[model samples]
Target chain A: MDVQTWTYLLVIVTFALYIGIAIWSRASSTKDFYVAGGGVSPLANGMATAADWMSAASFISMAGIIAFAGYDGSVYLMGWTGGYVLLALLLAPYLRKFGRFTVPDFIGERYYSKTARIVAVCCALLVSFTYVAGQMRGVGVVFSRFLEVDINTGVVIGMVIVLFYAVLGGMKGITYTQVAQYCVLIFAFMVPAIFISIQMTGNPVPQVGMGATLADGSGTYLLDKLDGLSTELGFAAYTDGTKNMMDVFCITLALMVGTAGLPHVIVRFFTVRRVRDARKSAGLALLFIAILYTTAPAVSVFAKTNLLKTVSGQPYAEMPAWFKNWEKTGLLVFEDKNGDGLIQYVSGPDNELIVDRDIMVLANPEIAALPAWVIALVAAGGLAAALSTAAGLLLVISSAISHDLIKNVLKPEITEKQELWLARGAATIAVVVAGYFGINPPDFVAAVVALAFGLAAASFFPAILLGIFYKRMNSKGAVSGMVVGISLMLFYMLKFKFGLFDGGKEAVDALEADWWWGISPEGFGTLAMVANFATALLVNALTPPPPEHIQNLVEDIRTPEGAPPAGSH
Target chain B: MQLPTEFCRLSGPARMFTFSGHTNPDNMDQPTRQEHATRYWNANLRIMAVLLAIWFAVSFGAGILLREWLDQFRIGGFGLGFWFAQQGSIYVFVLLIFVYVYLMNRLDAKFRFDR
Candidate 1:
């Protein structure tokens, strides 16, 4: 079949599967809707979480980032995956033990304070919304490429599809569909990697190909080739770090913690049967995730090397058909600013000419001269990754507003049906908003993905950890701490990101050199977290512990099955 | 972190050694809350230490501090230091999650604290 025919058939088949899952697994009650009846198998939950966790950034952007940043991009890989460890070991089992529906629910009950719950809710919405934006953008890219529609139209299509599937099946439907998505995306990622590895290094395995010796039997290494080319083009060594080291350290750490603290991810644990099951499921999830993470670097290296061989030193008129196509959208722009007739797409201030790093991954198969269909499969895979993560994030958004905010605060007596409806409606609304923001993403989509790590770290991790482990923590402490942590981190990020307060990139970039105590905004989250930790501690120490009634409730949550109830609490 | 000795003692299975109103029937007042606090705090601290070590090793150790020295070794087109700073480190990270979960399960069982 032709590429378009194959892509259309695949898209239809995938959609049919999603709708079938939604119809077959429609939620009938709050439990079915929220936590999939709390009986999802460990392997299945592992698959679903893998789908939900590997966002558009992971599929489309990570390889590009890795290819370009070289060694520095390790931060993305480690930071993103490391958070899972923190989640599985430090948070998931305990949160599952708490038997709560949302992170805010845990906060509310743990601190015995409604205000604290609401603060957690707001933070959840903020982080999830920012995350969903990237996913929406990914979805648009996929649709525009495969469905042959404008990006905005593609976003609308994705938004509608998500609203239909997510609203119908709730967590139950999403879980199964995510498993299917995992299969599709991983296959899509690996096929091209395997093909490229064989073509380049006489090896079928991508990981092996990544470390393979040069084909010419020269003493020079493959990475050495990349380093020489990039340096000659005025770019930093592909294997060197150039960003502010402190910021990189702080951001990477924050992302790791944030991954652990994200409520949407934590809630996946509740779908499992027992505490031990939660831990086991977390391991399974990582195993599924590692299949892709381990292969991404191989893809990055292969794609980058391919692009340079195809494009560099070629005259503008002789540029390949793919280059001409990409340049039309400015995604692969050719300045010819120096009237050089040749495209030089490198980092600024030195007139460098190299491919954009992100393009290295997204446009890899095509760059490698693979068949058109493999490229199309990649388009579909990227969409699946982005869409799954977007759906997960949007669920968190609606839950925070509808379930945590409206039901918990404004109308505590609202019927379960009404709350569920609100959650569904809130989810739909969030997708629409995300679709809009996605069209014109903020300047630093890459950095924003990273910033989410910072936000997740500073705001939620401390409160969630304290609530689960520090039983003496008071409501006042958790509330003030989250508010202060979230707001302070947001202000710092916005200052650098938007430059609304700083006026220009020049001013904000200057801050990297001239900031107080030499703390870059990315790393400033560590300080925000410290502030959160201190404020929570000071407030908890000053305030009275929960009333015996509340204390007893805490005890009840800690007891395993068959243990005596703590009474009235 | 010289917490009270009562914490170490409370590490075992439920027992009746009261220090409150009258340990008449159920050891209800024998400091379950205090014991929970100490155990939870200790477990969290332990997890923090291990995860932070892995995080630093991947990011700081591989990516920055030892990158130049380690770049002498090559795998495919990537140097040992370069790959660690990027690919190897990420693989280790995903592995770390599985290791942590495996370890935490045992820790929970040992502490008699699965709840």
Candidate 2:
């Protein structure tokens, strides 16, 4: 079968499977809707967490980024995975013991203030909305490329699927469907990688194959060869990075803390049955995620090597059919410079070919001459990743409104049935807002997504950490710290990333010299987080200590004994 | 690590609120139950401190600060520093989480808090 037919078949089948799971696990009550009835097994929760955590960016864009940036990409690899350590050791187990429905639930009850909860709810909404917009855009891009549909049409299709499950089954439906998504995405990711590994180095494991000598009996290691080819084309060596040390340090720290602070990722831990299960599930989730994370660098190596070998100095007229196909999508361009018919893909000016970084992953199978079914499978996998993460974020946004705002604060006397209906209504509205962002994305979508991590790191991480570890933290300290942190993060992001104060987007690069302490907007989160900790500590020292009951709540959360079933409170 | 001890010392007023009146049906005294909880908390903190040190060392210390020095050596075809940045550190992170889970579970059982 053709690639298009195969894409349609696989996409249809996977969508049907997801909808089927959603119907089977339809939520009946607020407990079921919010925390999946608080009975999910460790392994299943692990799989669901993996799916929810690995958004379209991780699945579709990360390897491509690594392929182009080379060693500079390590910031993402270490930054993203290292956060799971913080989650398991510092955050997850205790939050599960708190037995809450949302992150604001912990902040609200722990600080014993409605104002603190409202601040948390606002931060959660901002972070989730920014992150979900990126996922929706990713879904549209995949559909436009593979299904030949308009980007707006693709986004609407994605919105409908997510709305069905999220509004109907809530966390329960999202969890089971995410389990199915994890399977589809991981399988789709690995098959092409393994095939390319065997074809290139005669080793089945991409991890080992990346370090092995070439299969052509040249006795040359793959990295050594890529390094040689890279310098020959005026690009930096494959294993050497050009980014300065301090920025790398700051960016890595920011991403790690941000990953731990994300509300959607934290909410997954609440679905598990016990504190121990939360810890175990975090471990299992990382183990599952590491399978793809470890393989991504190897895929980067293979794709880069193949690209250089195929295009550099080769005749453009002799290019493969995949090149022409990708050219029609406007992602790959070739023009003859100096009237030469040969392609020049060098980094300097006079280069004749323009290759988009995203193509490295999406076109890997075609570049490696893999089967049609394999190419189609990647499309389905991309959709699964985008839709799963979108569902998770939508749930967080809706719950913040229905559970935190309406049920808890606005009308504490509302019945369970009314709250559940409000939850569905909020979910439907959230989906529409997310789809609108997808169809008409802001010019700064990527920058905003990166800033979402900074926002989470600055606001949520410090509040949650102090809430658990410090018995003396009061509502005033927590609330003041959050406001200071988020405001600082927003100020830095706008000035440097968006160039709001210094002209506009075109002036962003020219304004880099004015960066405070040489830190980019992306790395400013670490500094903001430090300021938050300091502000909280100084403020807490001046203020009276928390009441005795709040201190007892901290002590109880410290021990793992007798964690009540979630939502029982 | 000393922070927790200092906080516990300052939390004398918090001791008036005890789990003995409700959670502990063993007829244990308030002081004994508080001591048990404090001891368990210290033990968990110690384990976290040790593991977090290793986590920071592998990713930040070796992968970033000492990367140029470590690049002088090779593991298979991988420069030692590059391997840690891309692959080795992620493997260690997964290991660290499971290790924490195992140690905490055993500690919970030891403290008679595993129910």
Candidate 3:
């Protein structure tokens, strides 16, 4: 079959499966809507969490980013996966024992203050919206490539599809559908990787192929070859990085802390049956996520080798059809500098081509000359990744509004049905807003989405950690710390990223020599998070301790005994 | 760090205590329960501190801070530091999660908190 027909068929099949799950498991009450009735087994919840956590960035763009970024990309690989260790150890089980429907519920009850809940809700909405915007843009990229539709139309279709499942099924439907998505996405990711690995290194396993010698009877290892080629082209060796070590350290720390603090991911543990199950499911989720995370580095090495061999010093007119196809998308731009018809994929400031890292994964199958169906499967996988995460994020956004803002804060007297409708309305509005951002992305959507982790890291991680670990941490400390943390991060980002609030006409780049301790804006969140911890500690020391009952509540959550059964809420 | 003898002496009863709260209510009073809870919480904190230290040593230490020193060694076809940054550390992380799960479950059982 043709690539287009195969893509449509696979995408349609997956959408139908999602819709079926939604209809079959449509939520009947707030219990089902929020925590899948709290009956999801550890293994099943683990699979769903894997799907929810590995967004389009992980499935579609991470390898691509790694392919070009060389050793610096390890920050993402370690940072993203390492956070699960923190999640499993410190957060998931305790939060589950707290027995709340949403993150804000835990914050509000623990701090015994309405304002704390409002602050948490605001942070959750801010982080999830930033994240969902990237997912929407990811959907548009896949649809535009496969369905041959404009990116705007693709965003609308993605919005409509997400609105259907999220409005109808809530967390229950999304959970089960995400399990199916995990299978589709992991299969799609691994098949091409295996094929490319075998073609390059005579090893079917991409992980092994990453270190194995090339199949061309050369004794040199694949990485050595890549390192040589990169340096030959004026780029840093693929085995080493040009990034400042401290910046890499800071970015990795921010990403890991942010991952642990993300509301959508943390809430996934609430769906499992018991406190022990929450811990077990996190381990399982990490295992599932590691399947893709470990494979991504291997895929990165393979794609980088293939691209360097295919493009560098090659005549532009003789370039593969995939090159031209990606060129039209504006992700790959080539100009024959030096008036020669040859292409040069070099790394100096005057390089003739600007290749967006995102295209490396999307264009991988074609670059390797894979068959039509595999390419189609990649499209389906990308959509599954985007939709699963988008649905998960939208649920968090809606719950923050309906459960936190309206039900708890604004109208405690509202009926269950009214709350459900409000959740649906909030979700629909979120979808529309995310779609608008997808169509007109604020810069590259991925970079904007990376800010979500920074925001979550700076604002939520310290507050949540102190709430659980320190009995004396008051609402005053948490609220003030979050405000300060988020403000510092936002000020830095606005100044560095958007170039906003510059003193009346004198343009200043934050990356210049005056950059704080040589840390990029992307890495500044680590500093803000540290600031939050210090401020919260200082404030807690200065103020009166939390009341006796609240201290007892903290101790109660510390132990698993006398806990209410799941779904009791 | 405390000597092994001291560590073992301090942890013996905490490890051996298995009074089920429901089965033997009189044997475990509020004070005893609170004491056991404190010890268990302390033990949990100690275990977490050790594991997190190892976690930091592997990722930030070998992978970043001491990377240049570690790069003097190579495993298979990879620099030891690069391998840790990309592959070795992730494997260790997963192993740590499971290890934590196993130890925590045992701790809960010792305290009769396991369901």
Candidate 4:
């Protein structure tokens, strides 16, 4: 069968499974909507969290990022996975014991201030919105290429599907669907990798194949071959580091802190049966995530090797059909810099072709000449990943608005049914807004996602940590810390990214060279996070201590004794 | 670890909290509850401190700050630093969580807090 038919069938089957799960798991109450009635088993919640956490970026972009950046790309692998340790150890158990439905709920009650709750809600919305935009962009890319639809139409269709599942099932439906998605995406990701690995290295395991010698008995390791190929093409050796060590350190730190602080990931712990289960679920999540995270680098190695061997010195007329197909999408550009018909996939000022990093993962199947079914599977996996994450983020956004803002803060007297309705309405709006950004992507969606991580690392992470670990942390300190941290991050990002408030192009140009102490915008959040911690500590020390009952509340949350039954709320 | 032993001893009849005149209700007191709470909280902190130190050492230490030094050695085709950053650190993180779970469960069981 043709690739198009396979994609259509696979995508439809996956979508039908997700919709069916949504219908079956339709939530009936606000608690059910927000925390899956707090009944998800640790193993199931772990799978759901994995699906929610990976996103389009993990499935489609991470290997691609690693492929081009090489050694510097290890930051992503360590930074993202290390955060789960922080989550399991520092946050999840205590938060689950607190038995809150949402992150803002913890902040509001713990600090005993509406202002703090509102601040948390804003941060959660900003972080989640930024994240969902990337997922939407992923959906668009998959749809545009696999289904032969326009990007806008693809995004709209994705929005509709997410809206249906998210609005109907809320957290309950999204959780089960994510379990299915995890299976689909992991299977899709590993199959191609295994196929390519065996073909190249006589090893079925991609991870092992990454270090194995070539099947042709070259006696040279795969990395050694890649390093040789890269240098020959005027690129840095594939196994050597090129980025500043300080930047790498700071970016990795920021991402670890940011991952632990993301609201969507944290809220997943709230669904488990007990504090014990929360801890167990986090471990399970790490295991599931590592399954893909570890494989990603191997995939990167395979794709990079395949691309280098195939098209590097080939004449333009002899370029593969897949190469021409990708070129028509404008993600690949050829300039024929030397006025020679032969293509040079070198890295230089005069390199002939400019290939977007994102093309690495999307083009992996074609580059390897994999079967039509495998390509279709990749498309389905990408969509599943994007949609699952989009649903998860939309749930966080809607819960922040309806549960945190409306029900908890604004109108405490609203009925539970009314709150559920509001949640659904908020989800629909979130999907529409996300779809808009997907159609008119502001930048490389993954870079925008890095900004989201920065924002979370700076703002919520400190506040949440202090809330759990430091009893002296008061409303004034937590609120101010969030405001200062998030504002500083936003200012730095806007100045560097959108050139916001820099009059015309020249001022922006001047500021481009003005990054503080040579830290890239992506790495600046670590500094902002430090500033937030200092500001909170200083502010807390100066202010009158929180009232007696607030201290009691803090102490109560810290202790594991007498935890409310998980689903009681 | 000491917290669990202390909890096993303290949550006996002498330290129990009661809203009514039930078993050992007369022994229930605010200071006892406060003491139990303080011990539990401190033990939790001790565990966190130890675990976080290891977390930091593995990721930020071996993976980043000391990466270049470590890269002088290679495991298979991977530099020690590269392996830690891409694969080793993640495995350590998973191991850390399970250790935490085991320790916390012991604490919970000792305190009779496990449901």
Identify the runs in model 4 with alpha carbons over 4 angstroms from their true place. A444-446, A501-512, A565-569, B1-31
Winner by lDDT between candidate 2 and candidate 1: 2
- Residues A1-569 of candidate 3: C-alpha lDDT, one tens digit per residue: 98899999999999999888889989888878888888889999999999999999999889998988888999999999899988987898889898878888888888899999999999999899889999999999999988999988999999998898888889998999999999999999999999999999999988878988999998889999999999999998998887899999999999999999999999998887778888889988988998899899999998989998999998998998999999988989998778788887888865788888887788888999999999999999999999999999999999999999999999999999999888889988988998899999977466668888899999988988898899889988888899899999998877777667765223555345666898887888899999999888888888889999999888878887656755465
Off by over 4 Å in 1: A216-219, A338-340, A343-357, A439-447, A504-507, A549-569, B1-59, B72-78, B104-115
* DockQ by candidate, in order: 0.40, 0.76, 0.61, 0.68
What's model 4's overall lDDT? 0.87
**Model 1 clashing residue pairs (backbone):** A211-B75, A211-B76, A212-B76, A223-B77, A344-A353
**Model 1 Cα lDDT, one tens digit per residue, B29-77:** 3445456545655675687688768766876787667778888876656
Which CAPRI category fits model 2?
medium
Pick by TM-score: 1 or 3, better one: 3
The better-scoring model by lDDT among 2 and 3 is: 2
Candidate 2's residue-wise lDDT over A1-569, tens digit each? 99999999999999999999999999999989999999999999999999999999998999999998888899999999999999999999999999989999999999999999999999999999999999999999999999999989999999999999999999999999999999999999999999999999999999999988999999999999999999999999999998889999999999999999999999999999999999999999999999999999999999999999999999988999999989998999898987788999898898889988889889999999999999999999999999999999999999999999998899999999999999999999999999999999998888889788889999999999999999999989999999999999999999999889989889999999998888888889999999888898889999999999999999999999999999878
Q: Please, what are the lDDT tens digits per residue for candidate 4 over residues A1-569?
A: 99999999999999999999999999998888999998899999999999999989999989999999998998899989998998998899989988988889888888899999999999999999989998998899999988999988999999999999999999999999999999999999989989899988999988888888888887788988999999988888887778888888888989989999999999999998778999999999999999899989999988999888887888889888889888988988987878788888877676787878778888898899999999899999999899999999999999999989998788989998899999999998999999999999976466678889899999989999999888888989988888899999988888876677777434655785778877878888899999899888889998988888888877887777667754354
Give interface RMSD for all predictions: 3.4, 0.6, 0.9, 1.3
Which pairs of residues clash in candidate 3, taking residues 3 or more apart in a chain or in different chains?
A: none
